[model samples]
Target: MLDLHTHVVPAGIPFAASLAADDPRWARLERGTTTGDVLVAGKVFRTVPRVAWDLHHRRESVEAEGGTGQLLSAMPELLASWAPARQGLDFARAFNDWLADELPGHDGFFTGLGVVPLADPEAAAAELGQIAAAGLSGVELPANPPTAPLHAPEWSGFLDEAERLGLLVFLHAVGSPAAQWFPQPMAANGVLFPNSIGEGVAGLIATGALARRPRLRILASHGGGSLPAQLARLDFLRDITPPLQELMPEPATVSARRVWFDPLLFDTGLLSHLVTTVGADRIVLGTDYPFMPVDPVAVLDDPALPAGLADAVRHTNPGALIATLRSHVQQRS
Candidate 1:
């Protein structure tokens, strides 16, 4: 299986002790702790598992699960979302260089997705070359970048760079101010998190991003979040609502299908519906592994699913993306 939605934390943080409290470069892991209490600026951000960074353990787990390989993204918490532009770029370059060294080609089970500091789109655009030089396939950009707006006017240059490099832009959601409004963590993760992806989709369409940069390839996580469910409304309302009619240049579904989506929705009915909504070519198999105990391959294999879907998500769709990734690397060489 091409498990695209996996994450990794550094097995060890370099020089966590001396950095100033204001610097968010490398996260500080509490010394001598095996449980991975990842501290950002001396505060506990999140505790991750050994599967996050242990190659032997992770490869063994993927192999046991019948996975061919998985794409490794720096856990979103490590992305330095709100850090200063130069510092965030520095962190991303260093962090991603470390990830490039861990790819499956080096007897590990990871195909890496590099991180970029999207808070500064100009710096983020320039960082693509360094990311490519590190031999990474793509970038893990935040669905809701803290300082930078997602509108096309502000972000088209970054999109242009990604398209020029033939890079896959994985629009994964991270914690945002809206999540804090929820009363419980579960409500934030289960309700608010997925909906953030829909906002990303809306940004792409309403902001004239895809209209301006048609070749840009993106893969949004969580079954394109709420987009598959709401696209028909976007498609319908564009013709009637004056503001939406002006903002949306094409059918929202058309723009949505230009990107790929992961089938990590918890429901089979929703999965099947998504396949029909976006078509099989745009769907890829992605399990938030170690985070979700359920078997991703088995989810595709469920008798409830349409036949041949398992093979499509497992190989065909992801194979196309991987092919472009490797080709870009080869051209760089």
Candidate 2:
């Protein structure tokens, strides 16, 4: 199995220490050691360790699960929270450099998903360029900006460049800040645990960003964040909106077909629904390993899953996606 959603923390990237100093958002919050201790949507939930960074520790987990390849992403929300564009860009470059050195030469067991300075698009474009040059498989961006929606005009250029370079754009939920912005009670009631994930998908659909970058491959994490449920509503909106009609022949067509969904979902029913809604070919296996006790095979083995779809989710989908970006790097080289 090729685990698509594994996370890694590079050796040089300060873990808790950096969060305490540089990241005010998480620093102020009361953090817990285990997944249950961490608060999301005003409820305490356990937080899983990011295992991909620790090669030795993860080897057993990977081997135990019959995993042959692991795609590593930077610790969640690491680059997204940097306030300044320059600082975010610098942090992204440093993180990618560390990952490049650490991931390669591991018997081809590991590949990296580069992080971009989404706080600054120019910086993001530059980082994307560097990632393409380095021949990394893809780049990761927060599903929603730590502070804003990613489909805003500021992010368009970065998406454009990613499309031009043939980089796979992976977006994962980093939680929402509505609770932080409003009073605790109001925030608690109004904020959804994984609502940001849905917002990120909606933002992309509304902004016509996907339409603008047709060739760019986008992977949305957490079952595309409630997208499967709202397909009809988005489709109705598309019929009424001129911009969407002009950009896409069908309203939710771009999102339904163009964007891919990952299988990090803990609920078997949800995973099955996503496969049925998005089509198995568009779904890929994402364990969100280390942070979650995910058994890739168990997810694949779910009785509801189609026969051959398991192999595609586990290996073929990710391999094909990675091959596209790697080909670009080879051509450049």
Q: What is the alpha-carbon lDDT for the whole of candidate 2?
A: 0.68
lDDT of 2 by residue, 1-333 (tens): 777777765544433445336654431223323222333334533344434345766766688868887778875745456556755766677777777776666766877789876666767777888887776777988777654567877777787888888877778776554566656643552345356566787677766777667797888877776776677777887778787677555467546678887876666787788777777788877877766543543666767767887788888987776666667767877
Per-candidate TM-score against the hidden true structure: 0.90, 0.81
- Index of the highest-TM-score prediction: 1
Instruction: Report the lDDT tens digits of candidate 1 across residue range 1-333.
Output: 777888877765532333334565557665333456777666787776677777667787788868887888877777777677766766776688778766734553467888887678888888888888888888988787776556646677888998888788899976577778989876788887678888887778766688667878898988877877678877787878888767777788778778888888877888888888778888887887766655644567788898888899988888777777788888987
Candidate 2: pairs in clash:
35-45, 35-46, 35-47, 36-45, 36-46, 48-291
Rate residue 212 of model 2 by lDDT.
66
> Candidate 1, which ten residues in sequence have the lowest lDDT sum?
13-22
Q: After superposition, how far is residue 60 of candidate 2 from its true place, in Å?
A: 4.9
lDDT of candidates 1 onward, in order:
0.77, 0.68
CA lDDT, candidate 2, residue 282: 85
